[model samples]
Target: MPSAISRFAKFAAIAALTSATVFASLDDAEARRAGSSGFGSRGTRTFQAPPVTSTAPAPAAPIERSMTPRPQTTAPATAQQPFGAQRPGLFGGFGRSMIGGLIAGGLLGMLLGHGFGGGFGFLGMLLQIALIGGAVMLAMRYFANRRQPSYGAGGQGGSFSRSNSMSPANNSSFQIPAIGSGAGSRASSRGNRPSDEIGLAQADLDQFEELLTDVQTAYGAEDYATLRRLTTPEAMSYLAEELGENATNGVRNRVSDVKLLQGDIAEAWREDGQEYATLAMRYSSIDAMVERDSGRVVSGDDRRPSESIEVWTFVRKSGADWKLAAIQGSEQRAA
Candidate 1:
């Protein structure tokens, strides 16, 4: 039989081992090949789609999991017609009715012995048709010609003269502005704004790169303390949940040798007293999952490295160090 002191020693040893495992076990989010899905928050823009960059030209996959409420975005209706819609003809209902009425009245004049100005013979019928057609053609041409916008001597045209139109000229109620015209003044204003509004210094970019390595390192090691230091509360919570789920499944993930192959700024802005920047990065790493107890290979190869393109969002208060706010798998299917 074991002595009470010996049992106490063995139990203490087991507890220490258990504590060590707890610290090292939850590397799921960092160690596994994070799927081509996005999650977490990106400040006020969490639900908004990130802009496309050269490194990530294809549309990014929508964030699958997020703390921010997805905003309802209604697409603006277009002025263009749908495909294959037939336009109304020039000589439509009103024109046809006008021509028909002229013919009827001319024949009635003949029946009533008016004889189209007292001619009444075969030549009179032929004369009536020719006169009516010539009058109609002249009237239509004159009416159409009168609606033209007057031009200055310098050839610049003024606004069109107002008049009652049987049908709108060209059947258009509004003129579509040209591509380079001032129609998009509001959108162009944004494009014209200086990029310095975000004020990302070279130092800031360096910090972002440093954060990338630190975050992945802390995540792979299951170092919650480091993770908490490097990530926002909301992001840490999501990562913690992912690791817990993996731990519950009795698997441990490991990632190493992270290398940033390409990186570019996706977007940047300031709001709510915090500045945010989303960066698209292509990186490669050795990621694998193994059984927690026996350490048997369960998924992923430890010796082989895999590539992933992702958008990482970092947020910080004015003059504060940047912290990871979100990670989204980018549009890797284009590759």
Candidate 2:
């Protein structure tokens, strides 16, 4: 009886230990999810910029969000007329000529007798009038065709104008270079030129790095005010929600040692008088979660650092400070 009781007690102890291990593992996984990068949402999930090489992989599916603003189209300027009015229409210039032709034809027919010959006089007068009227109509049509504007070969007539607006001359030839071929040279040339096209400078890149650190630090501290100022309203909402969930679970996410490893501009553009830039960044940090009351680690390695790659987009109005607009995970990370 004693031996049987001993075995039963040992079995119960083993089962209990196994169960505790499993639950702890689950808790750690959940904690990692709570503090993971790419937790917040912003902008459309679909990739909109031109493709570029990056350490991060492409997203398996497009994100769900509204698309960013696009450039505003300006209406074409109206061409000024020499006399400050529209040119005369076809009948406006030929009305008198047409009237004269009709009068002359009638007079000629009346002058001829009603039966000059054998009842053929009236028919001959009618024929002369018809021929005169047809000649006048043909002349009018010819002049109208001449006055019409002519479009050059290969020109489409809809919304696009035939004349090149960017060039000083009326016509210009623009060639787009193939991607990955002479791209560096083209980029250098564009950098040299003065245009409205968006391009990131060294200072702008530095600011991006700074923002990455600032955002993570502020998030770890649960600083809502700073987060609101640094991120867009949409992103702010998401971060707040995640932080709330952590609080409800009685855990606090802690992040530190945030370091940017590598980064490059995925794309940049100006739209609706605002500038936007998306950057692919590989960074490392120490992320962990601890119990609020006991300060016991619930998940993650507090001593070791982890590396993650993410794509972040920033937006700003002209002459304004840039703010975080969106964040996406690299191929291997889950949002």
What local distance difference test score does each model get? Answer: 0.57, 0.52
List candidate 1 segments past 4 Å from native.
1-35, 72-196, 333-335
Off by over 4 Å in 2: 1-52, 65-197, 333-335
Residue 136, candidate 1: C-alpha displacement in angstroms = 67
How many residue pairs collide in each prediction? 0, 1
Per-model TM against the reference: 0.53, 0.48
| Pairs of residues at least 3 apart in sequence or in different chains that clash in candidate 1 | none
| Per-residue accuracy of model 2 over 10-61 as CA lDDT, tens digit each | 4533443343334324323432433223423333423332233233334311
Worst 10 residues of 2 by lDDT: 153-162
On the 0 to 100 scale, the lDDT of residue 125 in model 1 is: 59
Best of the candidates, TM-score: 1
